[model samples]
Target chain A: MIGKLNRNSTLLSSIISIILGMLVGAIAMLLSGYDPISAYGALFSSVFGSASDMGETLRTITPLIFAGLAVALAFRTGMFNIGVEGQLVIGSLAAAFVGLKLELPPVLHAIVALVVGALAGAIWALIPGLLKAIRGVHEVIVCIMMNWIALFLSNYMVGKVLSNNSDSTEKIHPSASIRVDFLTDMFDGARVHLGLILAILTTIFVYVLLFRTKLGYELRAVGLNPDASEYAGMSVKRNIILSMMISGGIAGLAGAVELLGTSEYLAINPSLPGTGFDGIAVALLGANTPIGVVLSSMLFGGLFNGGSNMQYVAEVPFEVIRIVFAAIILFVAANFVKQLGNRKNRKKKGEKASA
Target chain B: MLSTMTNLLETTILYSTPLILAALGGLFSERSGVINIGLEGLMTIGAFTSAVVAINTGSPWIGLLAGIVAGILLALIHAVATVTFNADQTVSGVAINFLAAGLAVYLVKALYDGAGQTPVVESKFTDLAIPVLKDIPLIGDPLFNTSPITYIALILVFVSYFVLYRTPFGMRLRAVGEHPHATETAGVSVVKMRYVAVLISGALAAIGGATLSTSIGSEFSATTVAGQGFIAIAALIFGKWKPFGVLGAAAFFGFSVALSLTGQVWGLTEYVPSEILTMLPYVLTILALAGFVGRANAPAAIGKLYERGSR
Candidate 1:
């Protein structure tokens, strides 16, 4: 029982540990001849400095929000959808194809592109989900493999089948591009676009769906304990597949937004954007909640944008951000373990005392 | 058609070396209930270390040892996190990946004097032709004449299979993965077994990375491994995590890459986009995992955090 309390205290200690970690990092920076305060000031100011910086930060957060939501949703249902990267890639390709080929009013075209992208993502994700539900293959292995396939397939399509005048897809028609003029005017020329609004709406939708709907309940129940849910007469298999598909669709939307709103076309060597993998960190930090994912995504976005600027101005390597991210993950994962251990210990103690 | 076959065989040997080694590494860790998702990162570290060492020492063999040592040290970190501290296996694995990547790039810039890549080593592993075997019509040149790593990879496959299925240590490792409590009752130390498994995983993965630098490229770049470690994981699952099965899957993937590269040489690109051909291996891997490989049952307690006094 004493051991349990100590374990629980570890969670509290983790918080203290994180602060200590920052101090350690600060000391190291000082020893390295860097002004920690100035570096941090630059990081924050570059992220929230001018309106333009803020706009770029928001722009970076847009896809992260969608990817984070995708990961979080699957996580909530006890599924590890590592294939979000693949889903995002395929989704973006689908959106870019539609944006370039389709002719419609601006609003309708954007909607169509986004929908197509989501549907493409859902379809790609559904394969692994169905396999897990019906055949008992683990989603982790399946998702990771699918991500690679999606990457190669998208790269191939953009470089070959969908190639326009260049080694990339044709630029989307004016009607298909998301209007960033408002953001441009607001920031005196920033790249933020309507994707941010869509991301927010999706967050609210995810929150409501997870907390308010019967489907959400079933999904969560299945995630918590599949056998228990089955004993309670829920179709665990169907729910698992559904959760994966929905998550995939959300990830797909992230890709679509990136292509249509940000890049305006698909480049053959489109930088992986890292949105899918970053979503993993975001989801974990957010505790897999809608609001949590949104906030976490923003924080990550800030770090990314700030890190880039730090590279440019402070001569700090952008890789430092990765180390920071890893440290945070280590800190949080350790805290979670401590909390679980403490809870289990406390439960045991309470039972023994009552008996 | 004959030339195509020879090219395919050569490509298969080239592609399979890393996959086979990495999958063997994963087999060691996962069969003992520790999921080593850091295989990719470990491979990257190994590749970077070997590249640098070879450049300095002018000996690919020394570089190989360096790679393995680096891998073992990194694996020790994972062992501490998952085995000693009982951290979440998946997240810790992911953190290791990030740390390895960040550290490698940072060190490369710092140690290599701001070059994002290592100096190309003159002492690369050379392809060896088995005298008589090399004379065999089509099969000899492609399969028999290869870098030493190919021979090591092939031998390791059987060795791994024997270790996992036919050895006492293998039984204990399997026992721990399947039922730690029962294994403990039987007088086995679960933590010790897991630590060993994870370290072996690291060593094997690093060998794969070293092979890449010494045999294939002779230098290390940021994206050197390029998610091949994850691909090995996929191959492992698709092969049902068996040594021979993984070999087959790796070879299958190798064939795809080989075919794609060969397609360019064969002028097949005039009809089909080379990019489409390049997508074949990844596409096939997904398909295999989704259904082609059938159902794969992971070890019980695969990712659970084991507590000493829980029971």
Candidate 2:
């Protein structure tokens, strides 16, 4: 069927684009007065160098997978959720606030903190979603504005609201931490925690929610053709809002996972975390699929983990990896361009045949 | 009291020039049926190029030219991806932002052996005071004693208005944005018009970037341009895509930034955090979009790729 063929091509295109991305990175390094092969070699060796290094890579990938799924879910529903950065910030702040302040049993403490964080993200996303559904406002503009607001507000909270007269808060209680003793021992005292296991489980949950549920079917239907979906007795507006809330909640959960699993305290960020923005690249390279997002995120995790080693051994900047990610998106979107041309040509041929 | 008012006026003008130039550039591209969210990246390219050239050549003029060229080159890549290949404009724009940030920092480390800064330039664009005009009561000193780009930015608004409404090229460009099929039927190539528009945007945006390095007392750093490009987009929408309207919007946003910077001297920072003060422009922008502008009509085919004989 045409649908199956299209899906295969999309998957094929994602793989090809990633290779192109690496090639582009290599060429960029060569031009910048560095040896491409050695830079990449140092990069891989550092990623796989030791158990602690691998644990660090997994820690980084854990947040990325959650954020990537957040973006991919929105992409499948035809909404561009550019506010993931803002959502994640609020989510983390909420988690940190509750984890440090609340008193409860150990497991209950962690659960409450994560739920509150996800709820905060959902509430933040709810504003733009509601505006888009009810008032016909563009979500992109609203989200961009909200991003700055969140950045400022969170910075304020960390500095003034929750601070014990310092810029950063005290660490959260041990009861709320997600670190697992066995995992840390296995990785030789690495900061690897239960967050990785949670991330994998969330990935499976998202996959099922997207492809194996009636709500998922309706959400896709609305995305493909809102008018048809509306005629078929679906509430297009409700689905839009629901999809955005779910997307935001996942991004919020990413914030909780990262905070409880690793740092255990929120520091005053000089800028918004790059994890949310990087998620867009991960989603695009994965072709917006659950399994694909995990695999692609692992590759990205390795690259970032190895970036410092590349810098240390080969004198190549870590920015070279950022450039490579940008290149991959460019090549992947290039397929959309080619498809546009083909669609027009086919339409022309069809008209001619009818005449 | 009069001195404070004049000082505020001067800062507002200084803050608004880059924004005005960038918004005007966005006006041209969006009017021609292409949504260029990469104006920020183009401005970054412009800022970095100008600063480096000015530092080496010791001439701000030559640096300005190099900055413009850098912006054009980046815009060309965007055009190839979006206009030729029919890529998603927003995604392409985001890519450009990443590419510009990474490449600029990478080159800075390579060339300067620093984290992400260029060497300070010896020559900067100096402010010029008009002889008689600068002495006129309250507005004179602030309005007349500004750099060359300030005057040029104001002139560009009128010039864009003239070209967009009076010239044949402008008509075709607008026509393409509203209805590409009509423009194609009338023998204008929609693709060519869009390419030209996007390139013009790049040139103007680069000049905006140049102002940051050459006029503002700051060296080129990773955060030099900040989010000015996005602010320019906000201005474009606030102005409802009109050249004069964009000028007004840019000035208003610029006023907010000026207030934030000078709030400490003005004693307003005591009541508000600088972070919150810095967020005023963005907050106002959101309010402006949510029904304050009444009705905003973007070019119908703004984000769509043109195809022959297709609706």
The iRMS of the candidates, in order, is 2.6, 1.8
Error of 2 at A222 (Å): 0.7
Chain A of candidate 1: what's the TM-score? 0.88
RMSD to true structure for each model, in Å: 4.1, 3.0
A1-355, model 2: which lDDT tens digit per residue?
Answer: 9999988778777777778888989998888788999999999998978988888888878998988998888878778787888898888999999988888899999999999989988888887888789876777777777777887788888888888547788899999989989999888787989989988998999889988999988888888899999999999899989988998999888888888888999877656686777888788878789998998899888888898779998888888888888888788876743466587999999999999
lDDT of 2 at B144: 91
In TM-score terms, which candidate is top? Answer: 2
Runs of candidate 2 exceeding 4 Å displacement: A1-5, A164-166, A336-355
Tens-digit per-residue lDDT, B140-228, candidate 1: 99889999999999999999989989999999998899899889888999999999999999999999999888898878878788888
Give the alpha-carbon lDDT of every model: 0.83, 0.85
True-structure lDDT of candidate 1: 0.83
| lDDT string, candidate 2, B1-311, tens digits | 77888888889999899999999988989998888778888888888999889988999899999999999898888888888887878778878888887777778887886467887877989888889998899999889988988998999999999999999999998998899998899999999999999999999999999999889755898888888888888888888899998999899888887887788787887798777877787777776667765666677888887778887
